[model samples]
Target: MPEITYRDAVIRGIAQEMARDNDVVFLGEDVAKAGGVFKATVGLYEQFGPLRVRDTPISEQAILGAAMGAAMTGLKPIAEIMFSDFFAVCFDYIANEFPKSRYMSNGQTKCPLVVRTGNGAGSRFGAQHSQSVENWCMMIPGLKVVAPSSPVDVIGLLAAAVRDPDPVIFLEHKSLYATKGEVPDGEIVDRLGTAKIVRPGRDATILALALMVPRAVEAAERLKAEHGIDCEVIDVRSLVPLDTQTILASVAKTHRLFTVEENPRLCGWGAEIVSIVADEAFYDLDGPPVRITTPHIPLPAADILEDMVLPTAERIVETVRRSLQS
Candidate 1:
């Protein structure tokens, strides 16, 4: 086992899959020669060559349309949308085309393609590029949405997404690209619809996704050290096929729930989790489930304002402490 950065893990995951299957192809703007805007796909161009790992035109719609066509014709294409925000330009292909092909054709067609996008805040990319839009894709039916918090999960879940029989939106958090984690040697693949209990405790359950996962874990640590409020932290790695069983079990054990999310307050992924907990595990809860989220506003371009808007470890700790006390 060795420690690897999240950025490198993306390359390894794509390479591993492309090597295993000849049908696997990659195409995106600046992905071939420039090695992607974030350099996450570095060395892929040389490793996979120009034909398989190609650079596409600037049109997001064209990229996805081509990928969808390729997937329909029996090629497993991994198309990068550069920034997740660009999904707005190709919403038709995402919401209507790829996801619906299998259902409409009654199993006559399948779109086993993966849409890889750089997502989340912390690079000061401003409102347009920094929005955490995983919630957008999760709301749509017939799509699998995944956001990995660690290097190991990046490679493992990515492998799973590539092999899946349906469409998958693979969101790579911009902030976590530099973070390092230990990954096992040799083939790494993880199951979709699985939630990881990163930190276990008995007093409260803290659910977080993508960038919020680390913050929630840090908050749990501080809550224990400072206020004696032990909190369990769960990393919601996948959103569409959400692991409700894991979440409900944690809520039952802790008897309290809190969600730390980078998405805006309105219709954030945490809200859905809160609704589920209230609906199914209402009796198991000792207190109302609280959601700590970014205010409903466009993300700021300035570093200070951005930091203020996104949920932090301090905010998580304070929110959990206050909610538990009340």
Candidate 2:
């Protein structure tokens, strides 16, 4: 095992995938020489040469359109969109084109493309640069959305996304890029739609995704220490095609559920999960499932206001407590 940053794990995953399959190509803004906005693709151009690792124009539409074309033409393309906020520019290509192309062609052609982007608020990049756009992508029919919380999961899920036959959106939290964690040696591929129960407990279940997983785990530990409450933490790594069975099973055992998400409460990912729980495991609930999410407003540039807007460990604990009370 080796301790590496989430960014390094992503870089290693891309490099390994490129080495394994020559069909895999990397393209995005400043990805070739500058190694991407976050340097996630650093040294890739030097290793794979220009044709495989290309630096594209400053248009996400162009980048995504080119990747979709390459994918349709028998090549696996990994397109980077700098920030998740910019994905709005290419929603037509993604929602209408990339995801529907293969099915529209009667499964004759597969769009094996991975669109990687950075998301979340905490870098003080303001509202434009920081937004959790995963929920928006999850709304589409033919897209598989994955958000990894730690370095190990980041590497594993990225590799899985690259190898997936359908169009996959791999979202990396900007705040977790520098976070270090132990990643196992050799290749690892995490199965899509599989929820991981990071901490097992008999009391209550907390469903979290991406960076929220770590926060939930911290809050679980704090609850156990302070109030003697055992909270089970389940990481829903993949948003679309969510592992509803696993979540329901956990809720059945714990008899209570609380979801933590960085997105806003209105039309947030938590809403979907809560709906699923209500529909499937309504009888298993000991109390109403509570949701912890950001305020329904643009992320502020100031650190203090940003902290107030986003979900935190303390908020997660409070949500769990409220769930128990209700």
Candidate 3:
């Protein structure tokens, strides 16, 4: 294992998958010559050349439509949306058509559309560029959504997303791109739709998705060291095929649940996680499941305001303590 930046891990995943299968291709605006907005696909253009690694026009509708058409015909395309918030532009292709083709065709169609997008509201990108909309994908039918917490997880999950035969929304956080972690040099493909217990505890369970996972983990540590609270941190890696069993089992032990997410609290993914506990393991819970999320408002472009809008480790710790007390 070697320590690598999150950006490197993503490029490695795409490169490995492309080398293994001839059908795997990367396409997006500025993905070829510019090497992606975040440089996730840097050096790939030189290695794979223009045919496999293509730069599409600056239209989300066109990029998604073209990718769906390519996937249906024969090629496996990994289309990149520079920002996750821009998904609104291609809702027709992403939310409606691409996901429904296989279902409508009744097993006749194989929808292997992989849309890799960067999400999150940090680094002052503001409301336009920095929105965590995983909940939208979770609500859609026939879609598999994946969000990795670390460089290692991204390597495995990205590889898994690229290899999956269904329509996979591979999501990465804007903040995690520069974060470094250890990753295996050998093949390590994570199982999509499966959640991982990132940190173990017994006092309470903190379910964090995407960018919140690391913050929750840090909070769990602080809670244990400072307040003598052993909080279990679970990263809900796969949003669509959520690991309900894993979550239920953890709740069975901890008896308290706290969900942390970057999306607005109103009808967000955190509510769904809390709803699941209320439905399945209500009797086992010592307190009501609490959701820690951004207020129902858009993130400000100013760095100071953005810091206040997003959930933090301190916020997670405070929320878990309050829930445990109740």
Pull out the clashing pairs in model 1.
Answer: none
Better of 1 and 2 by lDDT: 1
Q: How many backbone clashes does candidate 1 have?
A: 0
Inter-residue clash pairs, candidate 3:
none
lDDT of 2 by residue, 21-105 (tens): 9999999999999988897888999999999999988989999999998998899999999999999898888789988877888
| Candidate 2 accuracy as lDDT | 0.90
Residue 203 lDDT in model 1?
A: 99
Per-residue lDDT over 280-304 for candidate 3, one digit per residue giving the tens place of the 0 to 100 score = 8999998878889999998899998
Candidate 1 lDDT, tens digit per residue, 172-222?
999999999999999999999999999999999999999999999998999
How big is the RMSD of model 3? 0.9
Query: Relative to the true structure, how large is the alpha-carbon lDDT of every model?
Result: 0.94, 0.90, 0.89
Identify the candidate with maximal lDDT: 1
